[model samples]
Target: MRGNTLSYGTRYLGRIQGIALLVGGAMLVGGCARLRPTADGELLGDDAVVAHARLLQMADTRAMDTLLVRQALAASTPSVRAAAALAIGQVSGRTLNHLARSLLADGDSAVAANAAYSLGLLRDTASVPALTGALGGRQSVAVEAAWALGQIGAPSRAAIEDALSKAALPEPVLASLLLATAKLRPVPVAQLIPFLRHSNAEIRWSAAYPVSRTLAPAGVRAMLDAARDESAPVRALAARALGRSATGDSLAAEALGALDTLARDSSAHVRINAVRSLASYGSAATTAVVALTADRDANVRIATAQILGTVLPPQRSVWISAWNADTAFMYRRSLLVSAVRAGAMLPALSPASADGWASHADWRYRAAAAEAGGSARSSSALLENALPHVGDADGRVRLAAYTAFATYADSSRFAWRNQILVPALNDPDFYVRATVLQALGSRASAAETPGILASYQRALADSLNDARIAAVRYLAAAWKRDSTNFPDSVRAMVQALKPSDDPLVRAEALESSIFSSWIAAPPGRRRLDWYQRKVRSVLLPALAGRPLSATIQTERGAMTVELFSIDAPLTVDNFASLARAGYYRNVQFHRVVPNFVAQDGDPRGDGNGGPGYAIRDELNRRRYGRGAVGMALSGPDTGGSQYFITHSPQPHLDGGYTVFGRILDGFEVLDALVQGDRILQVRIR
Candidate 1:
């Protein structure tokens, strides 16, 4: 019945393309060899390709028409069946699990692989037996089944271990099985130790990844062995696992020694992870970490500065020297904050010295000064000095000032805290307003404060979706704090939002936990019309055989990424369109975590800006290996213009984010990127 209700867009395109191709084929076949149709009566050439594309569009839009997907699953063409199987997973078509499960035994490896991947996405526990059985069938199929079993969580751990125990498995399949084992709770760490020494470096890193997450004391010795691994990636993960398992015992001393050696390793990646791991040893690691303050790599220096701040005593002169020596904004900011945290009396926090940084030409320094003010022992003076920055010309500085005041300032002792804060709710920047709402909501006293409650109430009607979501969060916090004293007007306002036109707002309301009845009700299905229109107008045109590589020109250097147009057509189209429109020009990489990811694409220069809308995730089988480009999200289906590039293999991010592309070159540029690095332009080929 659902298939019978196919949108006009699907039918119109099929008729036009199919007829034109049929006419063309007749002319060609008359002059050459006759073409044939497939066993299912579907044409075997261009027509089938068009049909496959149509199924992908349905998947992209998250169309709720399951009957069409079902029909495609049974199509004679392997490509069409593969597309349909993937679509069922993308759309979360739980009802179509049976059809997808049947495809696990499909003759085509691609079809069976996609079917296993779909079952994983659906988390179909019922299909675990079928998925496990497919583990010995084909290389591609077995890997997907292992990953799917892992995605299914605890139910599949035993099967995963059983498969891992088998001898002579393909390296790729063994790697997938090892990574999948990480997803299970109370990981079988002992079983993974031998793989830490696997001849293939890829398998070794894969084993080390799970060990890093759930490192028990038993794995510490093996990890120490891995810490000396020839591969930097394996060593880096081993360093992390050692840190996690570190205790005040003999093994911890051995780990500390290995970490110390790794701290000076030639690789910056190894040094960064090793330095962070050393921090767990407290005073024992301070000396080794302190020596790396002059490390050649900025990221290493930043890591070293951070550890020293946490481990060093108050009177250590290295804090002041490091803060003064580094001219880099992020490094200097790290040292300054760390100095304050260690209870060191830095001249920078002094009233006269604070003015120098607060009035610095660079807004980054000014923001840093505001952040340092928050970390100081006596926050009142620093808070007072930062009060004027609440109205700074730059939104970042203003955001910092307000965040510091809300988080660090003693509201009871400081009379002007709320006076400066209450006015910011009306700030021009939506991010600032959203931040203020979250700050207000987190306070225990917000429920009794008429002004704060009124602020949440007023924000419910704010123009921005983010602000409204924050207001809903505030209401949820208030209700949880004490519902009997909750305001009825706020309750009514939340109720009104339950049926909001904005999907994000409605989703937020459902997430707020205030409406139990609304939570129990199944979500309504979205129509395929909008998605079909987007497919016809935007997605299809973008995929017209042009190269999909995008070169991101930054001050550091240009990083070329090959977009995964076939797998993530809509997301690629959205990014390419934005790049062409100059949307990402001059955007700064607002967030960067060492050895993790460098995130950018915020026109607002904060992490929150988008292209005024959201797009559904096109999650595929792409693993988040080093240089993998992925769409960042606030929640599901919230991807927009913002994206991030991984610095190393991130198994955790594999299925979560939309991996639309990957860097083909300029890896050094990716490693060198810091928080304030700017994207000069993105040139799409």
Candidate 2:
């Protein structure tokens, strides 16, 4: 962990060193404890102890934990009560809502904070008064209460406005209040302006968020002032807001000056966002683009490359030359691929240049080249060159090749699949096999049926859950495309949804069966119901109260995160189960977007790999701040193993990705992580 993180831990009781000991002690004492209350009426009974122990176990089966949750809620121990309050949200029982509401005034601060957080998840509007009351208190409780009010939405607007009207609140509390209030549909931007000019940078930045979104003409001065603020984060926020303003061109001169200044800011985060904002101004940012390309930060250079590709077409050679001259191909390969893909200059580039990269000594470059081939700008020659890498020795390169070829191999295009994709169906890597199957799914033709069916059958028999999922999806798509040609495919898909131990595989099978059909027949509906029943029965029990902690053993060092089982149980369960199954072992941190995130957990050691099935999104009010751990989904509910830890607070991703956990220790370890760093293992505690 970073030194500052270590010092921060010393002050933050939540990150206390003996957390494991505390948990273990709670469990041990409860094992033999009997039902008895002290004369003081503060002692926990055996039932309460047992309930607390069960809740602490982090059970995956949330729906079945209502009784235990109720018992723990009444427990005398503040920790037990806090844990229960959090659990109430996961269980999602109306009966527990009043209990959570009552805990909003719990004597202990932690219990109160958790209660507010849970009530938000429950969206209990009735708790508005209590939440608002808590907002005038300490930072921890206030942040949670304010966030809860936001989740309560329109109903809590008046209460939030009233809280903001009060004077001299702590910066953390006020900032959170502003953030929470901005999330409400009708943000009180007029009331927020004074705080925008507040001496405190945090409050200023928080005030800027809603103003930027609204882009009210009155807020322009505040935005401009914030752009020149001493704080890098505040400057970053202002710079971002300037780019989003409707009157961007009118404010171009001042905004550009701020952007240029912020682009060279001391903080890498400020510089990154400044460049991204510059890109948003279109060609108007051409002058800034040239300076950004030569930026000291590698990520800035990468983002600059992506921007110049679209806005400065004349810089094509400059971009290509930079790529060729950069000696650190291994480190720069992923960024280069992203840059190339964003630049859309592949078609204009020489086939020889693409070939050289495709055949590079580094597998990452080859993999990247394969990915680049999928882009619309890529030439047929590039695609052809990428095909050879499909059978390349590296599994990651092969996966990328399959992905690229799949993108290029549309149903209208026939020759490439037979030449490259067909052979990949039998590839040793299950992901490669799955990708190939996925590619063939959309091809509409009677001629492709037999081979596709054979491949589908092979995939269904494969041991990997992802492979089975791919097969079921392909079957559904194929059945939809040509019922006459693949008459049994739909029926086969429905049959695959039968009682299964694997929730991921069954979930995918059900989705493909129900949604893939062009017309949902009565039979399909019945099948969907059957599949739903099977899934709920098989998954929920295993999911209940499963305690989850992940020991992310990175190359730098090991860090443990106590997954937030109550708030985001599904995400926690997915991560914990995968860790226990050794899925994340040896996976590399594939993408490290500086000052943004350090992402890993793809088995392919590339961003594209997953367990092949997506779970429901458990989006919550949790902020994506530094050390926050979240599932890295491409879209809603797409998370599966691939997760990221934030380097700094990322407000933009707050409601987008599911924040399931936080780094309990090892901030330095997460800070030190970079692309290509291997996760030695992710031990589930």
Candidate 3:
């Protein structure tokens, strides 16, 4: 809601001043009013109206709406033309892109603004010239164009620099340009130095982050100046920014002094930020954060407890003592996460007991004890002790205990998860059943196919997405079982998957589809070209023209992804081509090791699925961060269509895998790939 967002509204026909007349004219029936020509001679009609409305949704047939929208741009009314500009940019196709670029050259100022907005989604360098030209034009168009440059990212670097030189652009838009530029690596650090003095709080705040990250000298000076600003929020923000800066002890000392002064400020919101910011300071900031743990506000105290666990985490003996003493379940949970992150509390976590928390009559305390016991899943003794809770009286605590067992379960070490987890596949709750499906899958590494098969049979009959997804996960891991009714079961789920609400379901379904596609392809041809077709016809083309409100659909669900094609064209192109070729159809997910990746696209139905070719690894700093769509490779540059969606940020893969795409939806589905899910089919719209 920053930058030029406000300008998009409040212009043209809509304003508060017109509200009174509209209220008085509420009975009037101009709702279906005729198109009235402005100074232009063109007339907008029903087709134009429909084309204009297309802007509201980014979807499968957006390409079909593109040409009609281009003509709508020629409409006489500013609103219709503006809507057309918006709709034109909402699609992703070469033809639609051409039309969207043309709108940037439109005669109307509003049309130019819409064109700039569309170009942001296009992410095409070719549109930079037109967008930059719009920025130098009259009124709000400049602000919109600045925003478009930020959306398009690196391609608009020069244009962004040129806009910065102009004093005409608003402070917020200029601030946005600086933030976006910082992410580009080779940013204009020298130029951004001036924004520190701007009257706008947002501009200063945005500038503060990149400067601290870049460790720019001018930025350090600017933050210091901001720390002394008359506004407490700005002072607090500046102080917090310095705490995490590379400025080291010098900055920490300065920030600590500022924080102490602001801790006494009247604003609870500022104090909350201060509590979190203490993470940037090691020992020096601990006292301040801990002091706030007893603050009058409940939320503040909660935040303080959370921060204390992070900043000055407890020792193992102290952690055990706190658990033995503290009555607040939430506080103890925070302490566990804190102690775990601090890396010294696992010994205390070992040897959990069954009725351990029944010592207290409170059901919540019992549940908390069970839940906490599950957190020690890495230790078999703890997981073993917590296993009985999978059938506990409280559905939620039972589900949590199961997840913990599955999360840390190792197949080679013991057959305990096999004995306890497989039977829980039919657990009543959607979550418990899902965990059981995965825990059973993990036991398959121990080669218990019979147990795996039984779990899949029970879960396949369940309708919860996690159950359906788990069946697919298990089937992929056990290809021998997948060759039977499994494929049909997987496809049924795809056909039944609700794609709009969840992202994990879609990724799993799509990944499962990749497995299915590999399975269905004619032998020997299941290589790079197969993936190319899918990316072109389905994936890339979906986001080619405009920024879609809801652009891509997968077997699991639908999502809106901001395409990074401008930065990773080959990677994006590969995804789109694979989607178009049905490369994801009927393919086994191929790889589903816990806490690693829910992978697919191997025709061999092993970890060997590929497009029969390789792509040079194009790893920037972004790497295989969690939920990233990355190209899986055999060696340095052996990447193809074989890819993985990691569950957590993996900086280890940064220089290895080529990160080309990311999940905009359906993360839960990837998490649900409980060792046996099979994809029915994969489609992109």
Candidate 4:
């Protein structure tokens, strides 16, 4: 079932501050005063700046540092004071909530903004009153306070409704409030509906955000009217609203007609959203998809391809024609990959042609070919094409080939699990090795237990903790499928448990040792002792340090991020160490989901590439707000090179994924990032 739903990339759902511009005088809002460093003689002014810088550099906070942060918060300079407020929030978490609340009304706007944003991170619900008042401050502080209110959710609902009902508010403040209101449950639709016809496009979109979420009849009618609004953004918002309210009955005939008209709108964004909404209609909207597949916008064509892959079976020819006609490289690549993911074929391309395309100079083409090789319908002539690519120079292509071999291989004719997949269990890339282990578990039969056991043995000795974890799973599945007398499986699991530095590996092995009846010798209690000691020595220390900062340089611009060193130290170290080694240099963002996330850090330009190891998750109370940077996990601790930045808040990911970092600067860059955008390098400062 997992492989059947082919995700082009892992969507690790776990599922910030405008710090850089305000602190550095980078010109954010017009006429806003700049924050400056305090004079040397001012009490703790110079010391505060130095301490703040050091605080930012630390991967985890020490108790002694809290005194220094508190002292800095009293500094004369607003910038130093602002930095200290942020540092205090980062170090103390919710312990210093009262002090941060007091700073919300600080004389300096920068200080107020920092305090507001930090409260959002701390999830200080009781401070909603103070935060709402700050929304009447300067534009910068108001925006930050608005975001904090949204983070507080249900607690701020009463205060926000009261504010909106009062005297007419400024557009900036109103827009932010509407945006924040959309994030809360039990949305105030009665109040929000009036804004549907707001003169400003932003307010209209903000209104649509919650309106689309509720999908009430009135909201749907409002959005239908909005679809015909003169502004492109309003139309785009209407399309998204329609898409979210995709229930068969909710998508009325009038609404569908409006969306079909918008699908041909002049704006590519509107068209993209319109086509995306049309996907939820299935075969009923086949005519719209057929026409949009040849639209001028490449993104529209790409979205149409995705719809065709899942919705209509007969559109296989149309999908292939669009793929062939697409001039945009990323669009073409998405079409082919998505087709394979949906188990659909490009009817126009022959197996010989697919083989030739697989060998094309571009790695994207090869990755597509590898995924296609797994499709029985597409691989009739190209079945053997992906076989040799198991050792392809590019890790992305090699990974795709392995998936193809495991998923679509002729079990009777080929011993892929033993010959190709088993051997690749020792692959240099951690992602490749892990994927091979999963493939073996899913595809290997009872007769192949011996070969799988041999591969599991190799995996336990692997340098990366990810490979070792995979070995435990592979052995468990193999044992479940075919019961054998090989005591080595238990021995190997025990060996992985003791003296292992990775806590995740130890945990897995301990679970197998205690619950599994397979292990014949060595009592489970004794094994637990060894595992507990290994955890105490290895994992605890890494988690106790302060957070660190990294500067990611993309082709567009540079953005600074504060890695959650204390909460997810192992994950932070893995990313920082990889960045230090130039692991992310010149890597392409292989996947970009509009209004969701932009994912990158794969050297092979495919979503599956990773460093030679994996790190265990360090999930915490951190919510996935816009600009939240977290590791991309396949399932459980599968996080590696891939990371994503959320374009909007994602509540569904809460308690489900790891939140490791938050973007401190240049968040605008994330909105502009598209598939194939390159990361020039990542510097762990």
- The superposed Cα distance between candidate 4 and the true structure at residue 137, in angstroms, equals 5.4
Winner by TM-score between candidate 3 and candidate 1: 1
The candidate that achieves the highest TM-score relative to the unseen native structure: 1
Candidate 1 — which pairs collide? none
> On residues 161-209, what C-alpha lDDT tens digit does candidate 3 reach at each position?
8777878666645655665565455557677767767788667655654
Every model: Cα RMSD to truth = 8.7, 9.1, 16.4, 10.4
Q: Which TM-score value belongs to model 1?
A: 0.85
Best by lDDT: 1
Candidate 1, residue 115: lDDT: 84
Model 2, 441-532: lDDT tens digits are: 76644456556556656665544455555666675566567667644653554454434334444445455443333222221112223322
The better candidate by TM-score, 1 or 2, is: 1
The full ranking of all candidates by TM-score, starting with the best, is 1, 2, 4, 3
Candidate 4 per-residue lDDT over residues 1-685, each given as its tens digit: 0111213223342100000000111111122132322232233222333443343332122222545556666655454576666654444457778888998888887777778877876678888888988877788777777777877889898888887786567787786777777667777878888988878877787677677766567777778888888877678778876763543474568777887898888877678778888877777777887788777654567667656654566446756666676667666656665566565666323455644566678777777777666654444434555676787888777878777766664553255455677688667665677777777777434455555445555665554454656666665555555445436655454344333334455445556433243333331112223322322232233323324688989988988898775455556766887888988899987777655677776665656445645544445445577788877765655566678777655544544467888888987687667678899999986
Give the lowest summed-lDDT range of ten residues in model 1: 13-22
C-alpha displacement of 186 in model 3, angstroms?
4.9
User: lDDT of model 4 at residue 240?
Assistant: 72
Would you estimate the TM-scores of all the predictions? 0.85, 0.73, 0.57, 0.66
Candidate 2: residue 506 Cα off by (Å): 2.8
